[model samples]
Target: MDEITEGTSQVDCDILVIGGGTAGPMAAYRAKKKNPNAKVILLEKANVKRSGAISMGMDGLNNAVIPGHSTPEQYVKEITVANDGIVDQAAVYKYAQNCYEIIQELDGFGIRFQKDENGDFDVKKVHHIGTYVLPMPNGDTVKKALYRQLKRARLLISNRYMATRLLTGKDGRIAGAIAVNTRNAEFLVVRAKAVILCMGAAGRLGLPTSGYLFGTYENAANSGDGYAMAYHAGAGLANLECFQINPLIKDYNGPACAYVAGPFGGYTANNEGMRFIECDYWSGQMMQEFYNELQSGKGPVFLKLNHLADETIGEIETILHEVERPTRGRFQVNRNNDYRHGMIEMHISEIGFCSGHSASGVYVDDNACTTVQGLYAAGDMASVPHNYMLGAFTNGAVAGEHAIDYVNEVDFADIDEDFIAAEKERVLAPTKRDDGIPPNQVEYKTRRLVNDYLQPPKVTRKMQLAQDRFAETRAVMENEMVARNAHELMRSLEVSSILDCADMAAFASLFRTESRWGLYHNRADFPERDNENWFCHSILSKDDAGQMTIKKKDVDPYIIPIEDEEKDAYDKQRIKAQA
Candidate 1:
């Protein structure tokens, strides 16, 4: 890292991966492996060793298409139908095709996976129609394995830097990005031939029920940076209205995680301790059912494990407590709740944008290439439709390898000084303020507005009203939000990203008039799925007049056709009682 002059640092690389999370590390590693001599820099707001969604480590692979258990074509069709037949099948298929290879690669890196006594991978069924979940009893060290590989690859790791915006060339190709150090508040300008945006999901866009600003289902650091940067860089966002809402532990804000407990006979039960929905997979339809259960006389949902034998409950507890949000066990213990004797209470999580769980994120093709030239995305931020952790590694590698080929043909583009100067002022304005509203206050207000106006069962007028309130919030943020130090500055910048995401969510919801993707975009004004009018992807992008514009992109023809019998399989998730 070289300093260009005072208050600014200039770094040059062949490829700039603007996230150190699940996808960015893999992307940087793969890019370097492909070219060897090419400079691949992985930038992170926090340390690479403990960051992103997997910082605490994952319990298992959510969408692993292992051989003999599930085929790529079957996995693709499952995701397509689960997403209400609105997915780009090619993209989902691409992830499925390469995910097994990625799993093998991770295994070689010393990450442990649950295997049967026959020495074969032990996969479980968690989705509506396919087996996908593969548990990792010792999954806590996943990041350690990745970190070892990243060091071996010799990729440049720049941590504690929060990327503010992307720097595009005159021809609108991605040149590089502008970032600010969260620790020292120093400005960084990286010039690269290509850039990959993997800044996780917009987790902090909605206020969690706990009232803690950082208490979110996704990592708190993932404050919609990638989505905001890509939008400003002229990239189209897909299905922003298809928000990610999970059934999490009430007040704790961590997942009840049916994927972990479902295979061992754990289920979501209403107040009566009886199962309602047939499946526990995190889909829009499944969430709709969960929401409906909460609205009914049942009122509350719980992870029903008390019915299981003590031995079975112990196995589930060992996996759940030791990995992927270890705090869940502690939170439970603090409440005097034990899996063997009592059920873990569950609640619907606050809304956010995440393609890792639902299908709303920056638009990308099968190759992980975004609409903008030289710009790519993967993981939660990219629209690959229910592409959990495995998709991140698979698509990250795809983005990296393809970017190497792209950079081989293109030269580094020049960034404009005027743009950099304008960005510097915009970024530093809060720090220079003598006194104004604090970042947390503004963030709370902004997210509170999100919960108030944007939590779906979607109404047309409320969504329109959300845009107006968001506009007012944006104005207040610009004028009055102040940060006293470098740390506060990071939070201030995140508020801007959160507001940008909130606005996009409302705009996209309003753009599509028909109800689709279950509770995700269940428009009350138009209460039916209008496949004839709204089957296409609703794309959100910045127009030439510098305004957010909505357009429809037709779904790509499915290479693996979904039969009529399978199209509505998810709609039948509710277990109907016999007459």
Candidate 2:
């Protein structure tokens, strides 16, 4: 049990939730629901006004239900396959089984989804399939809905609040957290019995990929903050190495972030301008399940054109204009590199965004509880279920429910205010005064390293040299990385950022020993998916001293029964998915 000391000026609460996004709020909301007397607080780095990565208007739940074709079992099966068989099976099942309840719970609130003429939930409209997920809405609708619930529950919600680190009581229990109100520049020390980390993955943060080079959805502020704080606070983390990359993002031109910007579309064009498909019908060549097309010139490819002036161009124009952000990192691409010296902007059409959506986070058992006491994680930050809409909500709800249960079990006691005050001063230390190097400068260099060294589908000997150079350059930056205020804090963050994710990624890359599918990780040295020795999930963990170690957690296909003769069924289902 945790309690705040009397006259503890700045600290408050029974549970402190980092992130007011999808999973964080649910955890906070559910925590309060279980213990009415418990004080719950949610902190968001940005506004609670919108869902960060996937947009706020449409929470795209995977709605894959057919008459008798799909079940939770089938969905789980497909999910594991889609993830390349490295998922936590129990966690997936728990989430899959209870996904509908989460959606129904959401619907019970004011959040609405599309429906058919029969007046049933029109989930399929939001997602391509409906078996596992609710075909959820975006952050605008989904986040606001969650916010409404958070408000109704009276859980304290703070926007633009940055969680500096997880706070542990003298008893070694994770009692709460330390944070800064980014807007007011004030330190906040929250003492709680439990803490939930719901920040998404380290993948989309311009991690070594086309997102850095081509501008695919990099949420800069996120910067693996949750993962860093957790690691710093002695929280056991797993799968830090496996941040999923989007295949479509790689194949697209212009800002890669626009890949998932509008509706799910994949318009792939080759150097010679040819269309490629997940399952190409024009010929009989089998579409490689997941391969790197960026350098191989064969992985999943999306086309880039130079105009969109047709009759129905209005729709794409509307979405594109609204969501388009300028490209910055590696490709410094304006309207020229993609179209070539101002040839004219192109509207990617026909194809849709494909999934390379697995990511890494905290290792949780069936209950989403990390090895650390009184610590919980959900969504991308919590390990399990990487980058899909349906998966996020499903697992998020499970973690939320379990977190509340954990919160209620703990008895209330007094928390130490002195520790919190000290934490606040530490967080304010960086900002109270500026480290010489701007956070962006360090980030840009890091992004370049990722762009050159990590970005793959293996180019050539030159790229290998580039990678070596990247390591050397990054080492210097980290060695000499200096900071003053927030920028200084960020410099330290960047240093940890590379090691935090890179250690995991580097180890995972080394162990897999082969470039399996094109999900960000690529080994030019070994360019093939070696199923015999390495067809497994790349599991990573940090020890008490923050040393990263990687292991292979193989997927046992036997958990869900399969007919010996029905192997074709698996292939068929996969084919349908690719289609």
Candidate 3:
């Protein structure tokens, strides 16, 4: 706690991008690309070899790079429909327009796509926006391709870095950030005029039992890091209640669950072998229709069908290096291909298991500006509210371009020496200080509290208890926290995020007052959708400490004049060309 201190090296730049994952890289790339003279640097906690969700070269770039049965308009339509009237239609159209470009951009960076037996591009069939399957490619390849360009640009990469707190200028605008280099235990003060927070959502705020869909079996690294930093800085967070859970798997590392497809019609079952969708609660019948064949006692072993053809196998071989073994005196793909070989046997459901997409995050204007001055968020860190995963790439690109434009217009200055020194002194002071509650301990306690009492489900009693308990835990943490240095300061911040965001997430969950959606959040108290009580957005902010103040925002339902349908179609076609 008090023993840990913040890093001390001070360096100023034009733009400081956080979280070297998805949006982070594209932001860094676009920033520098737009402004050739701008000094750009990306501060990544992880290394160039392993940053971004695309690092492994197999993340399945779902924006649809290949031609399928559907057109770009169809893609946009699917996303809008699946999102259930909550998607940013404009953003969807924008992303859909650039979907091919994103893939082409990645390929230009040396990421090889799976080719047909005749050495041409190939496509794979995947689940569509909802019930059907659509063709897409592996996503990990996308990450590797981005890495290639980043290396070409010589973007500054600070690996093994853990940023604990954001630095602000005299005007209270987000100026830069301070972090620790875990490898050598040194301090780094990154000063930038513009900061983009790409940190993921609430996996870090809940109990160990709480998890993302594909990430449920594996521990999550997203501590709502971006959410925490933005919230305290006056950013509004929306739709925090929309946490998606993939109930298909108990673990990503355990035995495959191929049998679920049998009893549940075409859908897979949980370990209980019961078609959970059969419960009386659901009225829409979307999930239940999927449950029939897989839930039937005599279901087929759809798991054994091999989906990864030769091209996919080759792509797998090219992307995974370290995980590969030697074949013919040359290393080939070293991966869980054994699992794929058995995907049809039992793990057929694994294909549908990754539910941790960012449905909600920091609220930003159409321009991608957050509530805080000189700070902006885009990509997954910002809330699409009504959009799904298809938007992350296009959104990242848009945000990157916006940040570059923003930096050009803002009046910039050098790094504040006083702030850096004070941070340095604060970090150094911890070594001289004595015992205090550790950041890890504060974080652990807070997560345990939220995971136990404050899930997405909003019951009256549970919400009140969670609200009070979250407040209590935050008070205890703040009081017990003893930090004279930078390291200790960060520990305090990490704990602060969980405690503060727990109330934020809970408030949003309670205000919604319905279990209208979410595979995991079933509210017994609010049994039905009370659109009257819950139609508006539930937004939360902080007044220092972790206390939550809730506000309601008007829902702007989309409208298009019926007679102008032909004109709208022409406009859409035009927008597609520009995008």
Please report the candidate that would top TM-score against the real structure: 1
Instruction: List ranges where model 1 is wrong by over 4 Å.
Output: 1-6
Which scores better on lDDT, 1 or 2? 1
Query: Candidate 2: misplaced stretches above 4 Å?
Result: 1-9, 63-69, 122-140, 169-172, 183-185, 203-216, 247-275, 279-356, 411-435, 458-499, 554-558, 562-579
Q: State in Å the error of residue 444, model 1.
A: 0.5
lDDT of 2 by residue, 1-579 (tens): 111112322666667778765667677777678777877777787776574554434434543333343566765665555444556677767766776667677778776655658867643221222232333333235666666777788878787667777777667678777665544455566777778887765642343333342243434444567776777667656544344443333324333322322233323444444443332111001123333233355423433433433433433333333332312222324323432222222222111111214445677766878767888777766666533555556665666667667766785444667866666544444343323444456566655555554444434454445546556655645454554444345344444554445434444455556654344445667766567987666555666565756666656454565444532222321223233
lDDT of each: 0.91, 0.52, 0.54
* TM-score of each model, in listed order: 0.98, 0.74, 0.73
- For residues 269-374, write the lDDT of model 3, one tens digit per residue: 2333323332211111223222333455534323222344655444443332222111211211233344234332221121110122425678766556677777
lDDT of 1 by residue, 1-579 (tens): 322223898989899998998999999999999899998999999999999999978999989999999999999899999988998888888888899999999999999899999999999998888998999877899999999999998888999999999999999999899999887789999999999999999999989999998999999999999999999999999999999999999999898779988999999999989999989998888889999999899868999999999999988888888888988889988999999888888999999999999999999999999999999999999999988898888999999999989999999998998999999999988888889999998899989989988898988888788888888888889998888788888899999999999999999999999888888998888889998998899999998888999999999988999999989999887889868
By descending lDDT, how would the candidates be arranged?
Answer: 1, 3, 2
RMSD of 2: 7.2
Q: Let me know the TM-score candidate 3 reaches against the reference structure.
A: 0.73
